[model samples]
Target: MSKKDYYDILGVSRDASDDDIKKAYRKRAHQHHPDKAGGEEAKFKEVNEAYQVLSHKEKRKQYDAYGHAFEGAGGGAPGGGASSGFQWDFSGGGFNGGEGFSDIFGDFFGFGGRGARRKTNQGEDIQASLTIELEDSAFGREKEISLKRVIACDRCNGSGAEPKSETISCTHCSGTGEVRKQFRTPFGTMAQNTTCTECHGRGKVPKHKCATCGGNGIKHATDTFTVKIPSGIETGEAFGVAGKGNAAPFGGTVGNLYVSVSIAKHPVFTRQGDDLHMKVSVGISQAVFGDKVEVQTLHGAINLKIPAGIQSGTIIRVEGKGMPRRAGYGKGDLLAVVNIHTPTKLTRRQKELLEELKKENL
Candidate 1:
C-alpha cells in the first residue's frame, strides 16, 4: 500500500512557504494534541510525521524528488525500512516513557511536560510578622520593619569573585557546565548527565575568591522595608512582597517575603468581622428619657443618640463608624449595647419622693 501525500495530509498547497507550513502544523498539532480532551493520538503522530518531512528544506526537496520512497533511505517511514529490518526507536532519546514527546511539543506550544529543561534553583521564601494597632488596621498605614535574612554580598556583587579578578571557562565540562558519565550495566552502557563538580555547574571559575562572603555569593544581614498595611486587614492575614525575600546563590530569581499581620487588641472596643461592638453605661434617667452619650470609635469619639423609653441591653447602630470593608467602599456599622446602671444607695429625700410618686402611680 502507498502512503498519503504530505501536502494533502497537512491540507496545504504544494508550493506553501516554510512559515505557512509551520503555521499549519502548529494549528493541527493544537487540535490533535493527545493531552487535550477528545484528541486523536494517531492523527497527531501522523501530522508530526508529515511536518517532520515537510518542515525541513532538504527533506522536503528529497520527498518532492522521490516521494515516500525517499523516506526508506532517510530512516523515517515505518514499513519503508522493513526490507532492511531497521525500525524507528525512541530509547536513545529521553522522551521514551516519562514526560514523553509531548514535553518537546509543549516547549513550543506553552504546555506542560518540561522534563528536559533545566530546573531552576530558586531561593527559599521567608516569613515575617507585622504588629499594627487596631486603629492602624481600620486606617491603612505604612510601617518600616527591620528583618534579618540572606542578602547578596555587596562586596562581590553576587559574583563570588574579587574585584579585578579574571574568570576562565571550566576545563572539565568545556564550559557546558555538565558532565556525562557512562556506566557498564548488565543490560548495556547507560550514560547520565550531572552538574560538573569542579566548577559546580557555573561554567567558569574566578582566579581570586571574594573575601567578604567567602565566595558564597550571599550573606546574612539586616534589611529594612517599608510595607503598607491595607485597611480592614485582620489578624493572621499575610501580605506578600515580590523579590524581597532571600537572595539566590547563583543568577536565580529571589524568593518572596510574606508579612503576616497581627492586629493589636483594642482597649475599649471589640471587633467582630467588620463591625465594632462596645457597651455604654447609662443612668436610669438617661434610659427613661432620651440623652446623648459619648462613644469611642477608631476614628474619634462621637455622640450616640439614645431613644426615649430605651431599655437595658438595647442595641443602637451607628452606620459607617466601624472598620472599613475589605474589598468595597464604605464602613461597617458600630453596635452599641446600652447597660443601665441603677443607684445602689439613695438619699432620704429621693426615697421619700420615689415612695410618694409610686403611691400616686406617676
Candidate 2:
C-alpha cells in the first residue's frame, strides 16, 4: 500500500510553515495518544512517523523531491535503517538532542523527552491580600503587612554548610547538575535529563550540614514591610514586591510577594470608574427658587447650585472634587443627585402660605 501524505496526516497544507507543522503535530498527537481515553494507538504512530519526516528540513526536502522513492535512496525516517531500506544520519542526536522533539513531549507528558533543564532550587512565590478604606484609595497610603516566611540561614550565609566545612561533588550525578533518566512511553523508550535529586541541580553537596537550619540553607522567620498603595487603585488590583518572598535553598533566586488590594465600601459615596456618586437632599424652597447649597465631597464640602423648579434625581456635577487620578494629573467630578424634601407637618403660618399658594395652582 502507498504511504499517506505527511501534510494530510498532520491536517496541514503543503506550504505550511515550521510553526504550523509543529502546532498541527501537537494537536494530532494529543488526540491519538494511546494512554488517553478513546485514543487510537495506530493513529498515534502514524502522526509521529509523519512528524519525524516533515519536521526535519533535509528530510522534508528529499521527500518533497522524490516522495516514497526517497526511502529507497536511504532517505527514510531516523533509526529506520536496514529493515525499512532507508536511513538518515542523526549524529547530532536528532530526537534526543534537538529542542523541537523535547519541547513537544514536554507539552504532552510534562517531562521533556531529553535535554530539558530546570531551576530546581528557586524559591516559591507568595500571595497575600490587603484591605483599605475608600478614602485611602482616593488619597493613596502606605500600609505595613506581616508574614511568616522562609529566610536564608544567617549562620552559614545560605551555603548549607558549617562555617569551616568543606564541599564535595554530588556522587549521584557525578558533579553534573542533571541525571540521565529513561521513560517508557507509547512512542518508545525516551531518554530525559532531570535535575539531580541529591544536590537539587547545584552539582555539589556540603560535607558538614549547617547547624542553624539543619542543612536546609533556610530558616523560618516573620517579616514585616510597608507597601505603597497608589491613589485611584481599584478593588481586586494587585501589586508585587520583588525579593520579599521566600528565600531559595542553596542561595538560589528569591521569590516575589504579590498583594491583592480590596477597597472598603463608603457610607456616603459610591464609586464608578473614576467617578463618585452621592445623594444630596435639598429643601423644597431651594429646589423651587434655585439656591446654592453645601454638598459633601471627597476633598471637602463644596457649594452646589440648585436650579429653580428642578425635579428630584437631577445630577449636579462638581468638577475636580472626586478621587485623585492614578494615571494622570486630574480628578474625577463628584455627581450629586438632588432629592427634594417635603415636610410632613407644617406650622399654622406655613400651612396658611401653602394653602394660599395651592389656591394659585402652584
Please give, for residues 1-362, the per-residue lDDT of candidate 1 as tens digits. Answer: 22788888788999999999999999997888666898876666567667866887866775687665533433232343322122223234332343322332222221122222333345667999988888878888888889988888999887777878888887889987778754332212334455676566778866687888876577898999888788899999998888889986644567889999998888877888889999989987788898999877777889999988999999999998889999799999899999998777999987897789889996
* Error in Å for residue 60 of model 1: 44
What TM-score, to 2 decimals, does candidate 2 have?
A: 0.66
In angstroms, the error of model 2 at 70 is 31
What is candidate 2's CA lDDT for residue 320? 89
Clashing pairs in 2: none
TM-score of 1: 0.60
RMSD values for the candidates in order, in angstroms, are: 14.0, 10.9
- lDDT of candidate 1 vs native? 0.72
Pairs with steric clashes in candidate 1: none
Worst 10 residues of 2 by lDDT: 107-116
